[model samples]
Target: MSESYEKFEGLIPGDGHPRWGQSYYYNAYDPVRCLGVFIRLGFLENQGEANSWVIVFRNGSPLFTRTNLNLPHTLARPADGVEIAGMRIHAEVPLKRTRITFSSPDCSFDLVWSELHPLADCIAMTQDKDGAFAREVAHIHLEGTSTVTGSITHRGEMAALDGKGFRDIAAGPRNWDALLHYRLAWPVFDNGMAFCGIRGISTAGGSAYMRMMHDGEAWRRVTAIEDRLTFSPDGLAVEHAHWVFTDELGRRHEMTARPLFGWLFPFDTFVLREHMMEYRLADGTIGYGLHETGYRLPWQGMAD
Candidate 1:
């Protein structure tokens, strides 16, 4: 029932929804250059700001990590593109492709993402409150695929971006702290697939809304979900997780994940932890993606 909402590629979460948020995000790894990029632009309507961050990783470790506490929400141009405070993400080919440019005193990058696979859908699982909040959170993950190219410059050294990447545009009214858990994984598998849902790893109550995309189509829109997550005592990572999703067709599929690395973002209200992981399927193929856990975790000593 979640996916009945139509899919669109242009700027979304327009002028309504007072609590709305829209995120334009991308992640890619360049094996030859041993560089990786993960950037996110969070447009929050209520706050009238775009809280964005950029993490540039080199040789498996972070080279640069920076965040913009608040960029004006006016930067979210859903039609042609967005340009805000030295960062610009404009369309190169409309629905199927885009070019992103980011410049700052420390480093800069210009990249293009060209679509290779079609779009997929996934719902964000939250409480069944029978209200607009549930409707807003339930609509998440308009996913896509692309090959990235261009250049990344840091500390006088430069590297070309010739990598495969996954992208998603998430839009909705969000009371982020109220969300306890959701898992977004896109293990870099040759199978050309991705999955997002909620199953294990929640102390507070929440429901399930799992969905999977395979080879540019809806592989499964889940009707039932089961998951188990084991987090480290420090709450910095989800060390292991297993999920079984039952599709609307009543067939079940399983997937397992283990972490490669993770980061924790502490806020005044909650802690957000996300890990990059390697996942294995029943067929023995492996892929890489993120395991993100939201809301408060058992972390003891981080400042807001």
Candidate 2:
């Protein structure tokens, strides 16, 4: 697969399906400052709508958040940048390096993301082209771990941003109503090892759609994942977790996590609770990233 493909670089013109959509997402957090930033730009081409979200959190609560769930899809795709829904995502090196900027009354940030590892093709982890799990998610998914550096101004105070980050591009039909419940975790450790795993219950049954990792040397697809998570009293965020992953080469990796901060994101048919967590490997190296869970709206049933 070529990384320079148009679909990987920016928004596709249109795929004809009303449900077809594409999204560019990025996040980075500083453990010392207990601060985190997450940004997303989405385009629903067939529907002629766009969605953008910018959220910054201090300690454990949101300092500023700008959510534009629907806006006229007046998007501009420059040769090296993307402008949509009040945000500019400029790529200096396509998928390897990016500068994302946003400005609003309450908050603003200009952050640069540099990929530290090769992009992972999440769909390959499924090993099935026509599987039920693949159909429910999307047709394309690419992700990478990155190092973030820049600055953010929130409520009149500016702060330097230095932290490990994660970015991903997803496209195709994402039928939210197909999922009953799902959990997604992407953690990058201090030693350079990282994991991205997802498991869910869909109408067809249980499936693990994404299970891959960077072992500091190379990327490998994990054969199985066993995860146990405990949520907060309100069941809206993760409190603690224990995970075990079995790689294709037959090695067992284990880790545990405790939440540092959490935020809730709701859109369309799902409510997502994204947690910034501090994780400890069995050997005791600490790391940070996102632990997210998605639940379908109880009122919506599976596609018939």
Report the Cα RMSD per candidate: 4.6, 3.0
Q: Which number leads on lDDT?
A: 2
Looking at model 2, residue 39 earns an lDDT score of 83
Cα deviation of 106 in candidate 1 (Å)? 3.4
Give the Å shift of residue 161 in candidate 2: 0.9
Model 1 C-alpha RMSD to native? 4.6
**TM-score per model over all chains:** 0.80, 0.92
Model 2, clash count? 0
Model 2 clashing residue pairs (backbone)? none
Worst-scoring 10-residue span by lDDT in model 2: 295-304
lDDT of 2 at 27: 89
Model 1 segments beyond 4 Å from truth? 1-17, 31-34, 124-140, 199-204, 215-218, 247-251, 297-304
Q: How many residue pairs clash in each candidate?
A: 3, 0
